[model samples]
Every structure is written in C-alpha cells, then in structure tokens.
Target: MRIVPSEISSRTRSAAERSVFAALKAIPDKESVALHSVHLPAHRYKRVGEIDFVVITPELILFIEVKGGGIAFRDGKWHYGRGDGRTETRTEGPFEQASSGMHELEREFRQAVDGLRGRDAVGGYLVVTPDVDLPPMTTYEPEHYLGSTAYAGGRGLEAAIRRAANHWRGKGKNRSALPTISAQLRGDIVKAIRPEFDLVPSLHARITDLEATFERLTTEQLEKLDELEDNPRLIWTGGAGTGKTFLAAEAARRSSARGTVLFTCASHTLAAHVAGVLSADSIVVLPFDRLDEVRGRRFDHLIVDEAQDLMGFGHLEKLEELVHGGLDGGHWIFMLDRNNQVLAPAGYDPEAWKYLRDIGAMNASLRRNCRNTKQIVKQVQRYTGADLGIPMAGQGEQVVFAKVTGREDEAAQLDRHLDRLLDDGVAARDVTLVSSSGDWDNTSARLTRRFSRIDRYADTIGAGKQRNRITWASVVDFKGLENQVVCLIDLDAEDLRGRLDAVYVAWTRARAHLWIAVLPGVNHALRELGVAALAREGAAE
Candidate 1:
C-alpha cells in the first residue's frame, strides 16, 4: 500500500493526479498495489508530458498517465485551455504524449532493468480527469501500446485500471504472482524513473566511518600491532564480535609495509570475500588450506582470522610451514575466539593453543566486546548455555524476541524490525542479516532489495564497492565481521541443536541490538536464556 518514491499517505502534488490516485485506492485489494508518480523526465521539445502514475498491482505493472485540467481532443489533434470559451489551447495529443513518455521510460528501463524488455510485459494507458474529455486516437495506436488502454472519467477508472493490470497476467516469470513485483523489480523501476546515481549502499558509509572510530584497542595490542612491528609471534583472543579480525587486518596492513604479508581465513567463501575487500599492498588473502601454494615463497608476516575454524578446516602444520620457511623473523599473528561456537563437528583442542604457546607466542585477549552491546553478549551467553554467574557486558538494548509460526510470519517479523531500525537512524550498512535457514531466495527477496551477500570476511574496509546495502550473511559467512545491529532470522531449536556457537555468533554480531524471530518450537530453549516473546504492536498472534 505504498505510493512509490514518496509516502502513500502524503498528499499528491497535482490535483488531477490526486483524483486518479483516489480512484485507484477504491480498486479491490488496493492495499496490494503500489501507486508511483514516475517523476516526469526533462522534455526537450518544451512540451509537458508526464507518466503521471505507474501502478503496481499484485498482478502486473500498470503505467498510467494523467492528463488533467480542462482539455479536449477534437478532429485529429489535442487541445488545452481554461475552457472559459477562450477557444482552446492546442497542445501535444494525450495519447501521443503518454505513449512517447512511456516509450522513453521503456528505453531507459531496458538499460536499468535486468529481466525486462523481451518479456513484452510493459504497456500503459492515458487517462483524462472527469472534467476533461477527448475522442483521442485510442485505437489507432501501436500494437504494444493498446492493451486494454483507456482514457475516461472517475467512475469508469477502476475498470480500466483492472483491465490494464489483467492484460499482462501469466506472462514470463510472473506466473501465479502475475503482476507482482520482486524487490529487485521495485529497485529497477524506482531507479529508472529517478536520476542516474553513483551512490553505493549506506553500509559502506558506516564502514568507512567505523574505521575512524577504531574498535576498543588495548595498549598491549597496540604495542603488538604498531610498536612491536618486528614481533615474530603473537596470539590474539576475544569473545564473539571482539574485533579480532579487524585488528588482524590492521596489523597485516602495517606489517605489509615492511614486507609481503600472507593473510588467511577459514572458509573458501570467507577467503574469497576477504580477498575481494582487503586492499593492503603486498597482502594476499587466502584460505588456510591454500597456504601450501606459498610454501617456498617468503612472506614478511602472516595474519590468520578465525583460528578455531581454521584449526578445524586445515592443519596447523600448514600454517607452521609458511612461517618456518619464509619472512625475515617469522612475524605471524593468529586471531582466535572459539567461545565453544563451532558449527561443524570439528572442535578446537587445548593442543592447538599449546602448539602456538610452545613456539613462544605472546598471549593477548580483548576483554571487551566492541562489536556488540552488553545485552547482546548476555543473550549470546544465555543461548550458549554459559554459566549464569559469568560476567556480562552492560550495554545494548534487551534482545527482542518475537515468536513466529512459519516462514511467512518470520519474514513479516524481520521486516518490522528492519523498518524500525531504519527509522531509528541505523544506517543500512551497519546492519547484518544473519540466518542459517536454507530459504535464502524467499527470505532475501523479501528482506532486502539491495545487499552484499558476504560469503567471506573482507580483510580491509572499502575493498569491494558493490551497492552500499546491508550485509546479508549466512551464519557461516559471518566469521569475523561485526555490525551495529543484526537481525537473526529463522532461529529454532534445530539451529541450536548441535551448533549453539553459530547462534552465539549470530547474536553477538549486533553492536547495539539483536532482534530474534524464533519459530515456535525453538522458543523453549531460547526462553532459558531469559528471552520473552511478546506480540509486537498491531501484530497478529
């Protein structure tokens, strides 16, 4: 029930357009439609022709033009005037004007939109306000422009609109949904009608900003990263969202200045993603399993994130081989925080830590959780079955948990929280949507029109310049990245079944807040973590 490019409840700027919009509101299932005023493009001929409205019903996209005020079409021409018997002011024909405007839009659309053009799905009509009338050229138009098109008065408006919508039903990929729009389609249409943009997702802005406000760094860690640039061995530890990976990248960049740095992540997705985002000179981000490629080559230093996952994925010896042979003095940094949060069957044994310690590596831990609020950390501890007496961080809003019955309910719940955050000044870039649920297509299509699916962690900020949308990551994708807020979707007993650590990681990703949509059966477990399921305002039980 939105009027695209503007608020639906806001008053329309044009009187004639307002009348048409009011009539559209009277159509059946009007709430299922979106009324858009395709801001008219610049007219080179100095003749004003507007696309007026692009109505998106649940079935199809109906682009309608409103030629209001006192106007008429007589003979083979179009005319306009105050109609005070000052004769008539002849202008461009309404059919020709709207048709050309729509034609121009379609052309722009072909470039901006992806799955359009060949679908033969786009076509619209010309509508005159009740006060205006024309025996305009309604039928002698192009075949593509004549699909149930109409020019008529107020009462007949709904029927014409319906016919226009029904015209494109069952075409192309729009099977049962017919004219329904996906988030991508909505983005394309809005972008096409608007001015061209070079804007990236707002998240990128937040990320650039986060770099300036450095995470809570300790003096010992600072000395290790900057002061002891020659320190050949070190182990960094922190709980979830403690900025371990960020520091590792920072260390890698500084270390690279001295010589080539080899950076490694745990998962392939995480490694490729890190490779995409990390831009430090002489640093190559790779998966730990791929470390063998650099066996004979000497790297100035080595930085590894998610050491636990790496320990489980590949052997520590592979990493040892890289250090033993290459670099000046075996400079290496291993960042780890297991928190007993392993999703797979793999577990990190004391032997892993003992091996590094045996090599004279200094141990340093980040005591504070900089990525998540205190409440979020508490909730993570709760869900992980951490001892009740364990200390907690005192910041962040109480984790909000709302029970959902199924997929649809979960989606609606997520949307509400996201909208609330956006309205509350949370940048889109600072948000991460984490879910282990397999329903990515249905979930992502609904949650975001723009997002970066970070299958891996970036080693540096501002590495990849995709649209600045929020990050939609799988539980596996969110290894070292932290966000201002995280909305964990599809949480259930099944998700916490064997890998509470995955759930722990998801909850801790949020810096200021954590919103949970728990499918019914799972709440029993989450309830033990002190989560209360309340009905949102105006939400159905």
Candidate 2:
C-alpha cells in the first residue's frame, strides 16, 4: 500500500489516529493508497469535519474514524477521555462522525469531479477504537466497527476493513449490483477528494528537501565544469535560477585544489554567502569593490560570479591586472546572467564581453534552471519576459499574487501571509521580505514599525547575527541569493516596470514559493503583460 503523504505528519496529535494510519500501511494490497486526515469544509449543520483516514483500494473507498484513549456513551451523549486525565463530551459518537464525514466526502467528490455523480462508486465508513474493546452496538453493523482486540499486529485491522468492504459489496440487490470501481476511477476519486492536501508537503519539509537537493552541483553544471579542463578562460551565461552562481563557486572550489583562487561577485551579500559555502584555505571570496585589498597581488585563477554587473572596460582591466598572467594569458572563469544586466549601475558592456571572447574564452549557455520550480518560472516569464531555462526543480507551491490598495494594505496583507506561513511550519529565516518600492521611505516606514524581528540581510550577514530571524533585503543586494520563500511587497507599477531586470531578479529569488503584494497599477501592468492577475487578494494559481 502507498500512503498519500508517504509519512505521517508530525502535527497529528491523536495516538489512535496515528495507529490506524500505521495499520493502513500494513494492508497487503500493493495498489492501495491511504490519505490521512482529509478535512472537509463546513456545510449545512456540520462545523467542518475531518475524516481520520480515507483508504482507496482497487475495489472500494473506505473512510475510518478513530477514537483514542477511553470512550463511553450514556444519556444520548459520548465521553472521550484524554491522556492528560481530562474528559470531553460530544453529542455525536465516532459512528455518527464517520458516517457524516463519509457522506460529505461523497458529496464533495461528486461536485468536484465531472461525470462522477451518476457513476456508482463503492465507499463505506468504519469506526476504530484502538484503546477500547467496545461491545457490539445494536445501532450499527458489527463488521463496521473495530475494537482494540481487532488490532492484532495490524492484520486484524486489515481483516475488519475487508469485512466492511465486503458488507457494502453484498448490500446491493440483483437489479442494482455494486459496480466494480476501476483503478482509473479510483485514482480520479482520490484526486477529486484531496488533490492539494495529498500532494503539497509542509513548507518546512519543502525547504529541507529542496535545499538538500540544491546543495550538490547538477549534472549539467558538472559537465560545464569539465569545459574548464581544456579552456581555462570560460564565460558562462544564463538567466535567473539557472545555477550560475553555484557553478561559479564550484569552479572556484575545484581550482583551489590546483592553486590560489580569487572568487568574487558584485553584491557584498552574495560574496558573503558564497564565502560561507566554499571554505577552501586557498580560495578568497570578496566583493568586486574590495579588489583593492589585493591591488598589487596576483591570484593563480580568477572566478567571478554575477559577472554581468562588472562587465565594464575599467572593471575588466582591473581584473586583468589582478590575475597572474593578465586577461589574455590568465586562467579565469566568468559566470553571469545576461538578462539581469540592467540591475547593474553601468549595465553590461558589449565591448567588454567581446573582449573576453576575443581572448579565446569559451562561452557556455546554461538553460536548465536548477533553483526555481516550474510554477515560479512560469510566473517570472509571464511578467518579466525572462525565460529562466526549463525549470528542473519540483512543481512547488503556486505563485501567489495579493492585490493591495496602499502601503497600509500591503503591510496588513504581508502580516497575514507571514502568519499563514508560520502556521505552515516555515521558519522565519526561510522567508526573505523584498521591497519593490523604488523609494525606501515609501515602503520602509510601515514595515519597520510592524516587524521588529526583521533584520536587513546585509546587516545580518555582516554582523554574524543569528539567522533564526527573518531578514529583509533590497532587490539588488538579494540578486544572487535565494530563500525557500520570498515576499515581494510594496510593488508600484511605474517603479516595477522601469526596473524589469530588478523585478526578474527579485521574483526568481524564491526557490520554492513566491508571494507578491501588488498595487492596483502594478496589477494592471502584469495583466497587460498577459499575466493573470489575482481575482482576489492572496489567491494562487
């Protein structure tokens, strides 16, 4: 059997529910899939119900309601004891809860999926009490309930479920026999029941998973590194999320094995980030402006990340002087994003790029995006006109767009988003708050007053402060760095449109999720660019 979540969530509090979830995994049927804690929206008299476990097999779909601790019924009421030595009363018992949730699930399934209302789908409900061996109740069928005695190393639980399924299979008469639920229909039912809930893991889990996968050099990046074997001087160009900075740092790390390597980038923040990652004693990571420290000194090799920002004749000349053999004879590698050249003060210089090529530097274009997810790449392309390669990451959370009326509204919306993210188990450090307002005064006042825990990314890196706190950053300083979650706030249409390159860089800074708070004008501009505007605030694709 396959579990929808693959692992039981840490948030699940009920011990009995956890036991049932584990027992469901013991089902011998290899094709079965069990979804735990399927939440159903409130409807009519029901105040939002949760089905403990929904087991979908090739033959039937079964909903299980579990009662833990001590359970008893008297005076038309049910009492459940807690591990904390407390008792809670409920008017409806486990059997009623199971039946109500099962019917509600069926109704929701029919409404969500097309052509499924008329199809005879086999579904039943069962009540499980893992800690109590309840006597047979006259109100419900004996096969529909499982006591503690029935949990014989999970095999007895499996037997009870099979018996309940058979009961439903036998209930149908000759004229209207229960139809055999095909595997395709069962899969469709599973999707219709809990599509997003079953697929999207907690934000904390996503960050850990994505960061683990991102720590290594991708196959394409390794292949690009191989090019350095023959050509010491190489120019690697790509759009955002294409792993340009990663390749640059890795190149520096490899070259450090041979000789002294000077790895540098435009942003001081980015330089600090790369410095922490590559700790080779032979490698020196520094910002471009700090090159004066080694003005008269020479390095065996030069590796520049975010090289697009320093593609000026003067900057290239300085770099040439710093290398042991100068530009033409020196061994060096330049990694840059051509699409983000506008982010630089002087912008990219065509003559300087030509200068590198004229000196026998091999150019390699990275087209596989190793950072952002497919949904984020789609959003970036639609708004910024930046094709960040084919996204090779997971199908992450959808890009969210929140329409705000003013600065106050933006602040309020961001607060709401932050609360939700915190609830989803995302750490404060995993989120970076990006201000899109051109003027600092236009956006900084309310944010600073509202979020006291937020520290500037540059300051955090410089001061060596604890990173367990949220960080704020300007679009330019956050150019080569990425977080699991990013919130782009205070977007002004005119300001954003003027710095499309900055917008490109800011939006791509999120590896898994991107949440944008857009003003009316900015929202309209995105719509004009064929980007779908959010129908409502906080709506995601």
| Best-fitting candidate, scored by lDDT | 2
Scored against the true structure, residue 460 in model 2 reaches a CA lDDT of: 69
Q: How high a TM-score does candidate 2 get?
A: 0.58
Model 2, position 474, has a per-residue lDDT of: 81
How well does candidate 1 match the true structure in TM-score terms? 0.52
Q: Which stretches of candidate 1 lie over 4 Å from their true place?
A: 1-216, 268-278, 292-295, 312-314, 324-329, 341-345, 385-394, 442-463, 527-541
Per-residue lDDT of model 2, residues 1-541, tens digit only: 6665444544456778777777887677777777775232212223223577788876678988888999888998899998899999999888888888888877877788664778766778888888888877776888789888877545688788788878876675442466776777777776665443432222222222323221434556645765765687888889888888766765676577568999988899888777766666888889999999988889999998888888889899889888889888999998888775534435778888788778856888999998899999988777666658989987998999888888787788888888899999998889988877534555643564447777778776766555777778888788888888999976788765556676788899999999998887886777754442222212532
The regions of model 2 sitting more than 4 angstroms off are 1-214, 341-346, 438-450, 528-541
Per-model TM values vs. the true structure: 0.52, 0.58
